[model samples]
Target: MDTAPARDSAPPRTTAADARRGAPASRRPVLPYLLIAPTVLALAVVLGYPLAGLLLLSFQDMTRRELFSGAAPPWAGADNYRTVLTDGFFWEVLARTLLFTLVCVGVTMALAVPVALLMRRVDPWLRAVMAGVLVAVWAMPVMVAASVFRWLSDADDGVLNWLLGLLPGVDLDKHNWFYDPWQGFAVIAGVVVWGALPFAVLTLEAALTQVPRELAEAAVLDGANARQLFRHVTLPVIRPALVLVTALLAIGCTGVFNEIWLLRGGRPESDYYLLGVYSFIESFAVNRYSTGAAISVITVLLLLGGAVVYVRRLRALGEIE
Candidate 1:
């Protein structure tokens, strides 16, 4: 007892765990903030600064000449915003973007659900093969895909025209796909949906695995067919994942440019201009930086609204707090 007391009196040595548990109240909270400060500072510099500058620029009159020259840009309070917002061209582009997003999301979800469910019930080898294909497509670079799409859709001696020529009563050799707005937009929608499906299918498959098979089995035993079982059982379980994917896809499709640009075949006067392309043209091609910034701000607001709606729906369904 004397020896023990003497040892105890020597002062308690701090272990790693002890240090963590016994960290001073003042230091503990500050330590976490200290650790995160670097990341926060980096993000502020990289993302926040640019976004703040864009917002400020949107409120100013930044013309092409001032953009090129070293002269200070003139201030035009809400003028750029008003000009961009009131422009008929901007609204048309925005409408096209929204329509494209709707088509892409609708088709992607429709195909992804079946594909995901199929992956669960398929043979091991088949499932592996399918998953590999999806992962490969999902991992494909956007630039590479765009390049391939450009090659396939080329006006002169393109594969699409060659294939069309093979069909009876048709001769589409060297046809320009971007000439017709509807046809061009439809083709774009197809490509976007194809590229987008892999991600949705893979995500849904992962989410489906978390769902209890017992519920599905119980539903099947109660005289429920495949459609009913999926409707009543699997739908609820995967609804959250579905909603998340929808929101992500909506945001992504709204800002899609690479594939659309490639499909548009570099035609500056093409009627197939979506919001993304319009913004690019204004900012870079026309050097209307403030107008482009205003468009970007509107796009951000649209995404925020989509996110808000997603959260509200999910909350209404009691999927999240």
Candidate 2:
């Protein structure tokens, strides 16, 4: 009886290509690729090309003579790295760079967190005012910030010194901040922290405002104190933002040249020569493009390594959510 009548065959299944053809034009993959093409091209030209050239140069003794004369020399192998590593100044610069980055990141977060919390409670008008100030600070060109900080930190005819004189119990000297390495580090760190605060505040403020009211109410109902609620709930929710802020700060710190160069321009003998400064000196002062490239490559590698490690740690902690 079952074989008496043949069942009608089901409609043919759709292949991916057939399905794509039937899909809406806006949902096509080609449109997305076209939209992203310009950005990808720009990134390759600006970032990728330079990085490739720099890596190639790092492997050879690429002097100005050889470059102009078109006479390639033998490869130096890892000599450039060896020279950079064995130098005492390199170690000092590395230490200063790390210390500056760490301290500035900590100070920036410390300043940002309270401001973000306060922003959550403020009236709309005050919030707008705060946002305006932060935007203004963020919009200040990096070079302008460096110049303003330099003028303010000047030993003579400087506003900071003038302000110090106003204090009743303090007697101060016209200390040459740019001359002393420690003082220069402090000044640079302070400027970086100040410049970075706006971004950190904005980011953290947005994150803090997004903390669910239901969660806060539940915490309160569970007899959680203000400190406990903030420590357990608020901090965990904002951990992603904190990591992002630290990564940005670290990247910026590694490439700090303008401030140190402008402030300590004539002092290579001083202990404030950072890797960026070193790279600049090699390229311009010594006309050693290869050496400069090597330094840049090393800096980039270090930064990328740090980022990779941070991402791995984030994955390990499952904090991305």
Candidate 3:
């Protein structure tokens, strides 16, 4: 009776390989790589080619004349690099660049994150108004904001000086904010930080909203103080957004030229120059194409180093894990 009740033979046991073989063509692991191949190729053509050319150009003794001439660029080994690296001016400019990038990133993030947090606690209408302002500020074009800030700090009839003049014994009339290098850097810092703050605020605000309110309540119920609650609960949840914005701002600020150029006025001294400005002035203004290329290469390397540090920081915080 038991033999008669035996079930039909089961299907063959499928191994991983067999299962993969049975999957749709599009579902195969290699399909995504295939689909992205064209995009990768296009990007290589666009970015990789130019970067390779820049690297090659950096090692050669190239100039505007040599580039335009019907001859190959001269091979100079590390002459261009030596010239850039050994120059006292380049180092000074680099220091200023680091200072500028750090200040802008630090000040912007410090103010923006707090403002974003406060927005969640405020009345909805006030929060709406605040968000609108941030959006409007963020939407303003870079050049427009730069130009506006330039006008605001104008030596003659600027609104900032106008307001200062109204206060008793505090007439900042016709104050040339960009006359000194430190002061010029300060003004540029102000403009850059202000322009960047709104985006940071919005990013943090979105991240803050995604954090579960229950975690905060749970922390409070466990007798966590205000500082402890934020440090333990809120900070970890939004750490990813914080790291992302910080890295992005650091990278963007490292390449800053437009704001400095517009705000500092044209052809500022080495004291006020950042790496990008230095590269531009060396390449175009002074016709040192090879030197500029070397500077560009150095800047790229520095940025890569920064990116590595940022990644390591995130990993250390377990954000990446």
| Candidate achieving the largest lDDT | 3
Winner on lDDT (1 vs 2): 1
Best model per TM-score: 3
**What is the alpha-carbon lDDT of model 3 when measured against the actual structure?**
0.87
Question: Which ranges of candidate 2 are over 4 A from the true structure?
Answer: 1-41, 70-73, 265-269, 317-321
For model 1, residues 52-138, the per-residue Cα lDDT tens digits are 998898888888678679687888889888898888888888888888899889989999989998999999899999999998888
| Cα RMSD to the true fold for all candidates | 7.3, 6.4, 5.0
Off by over 4 Å in 3: 1-28, 31-39, 124-126, 317-321
lDDT of model 3 at residue 194? 79
Estimate the TM-score for candidate 2: 0.83
| Candidate 3 RMSD to the correct structure | 5.0
Global lDDT of model 1: 0.84
Q: In model 2, which range of ten residues has the least summed lDDT?
A: 261-270
Worst 10 residues of 1 by lDDT: 1-10
Q: Which regions of candidate 1 are displaced past 4 Å?
A: 1-43, 68-71, 164-166
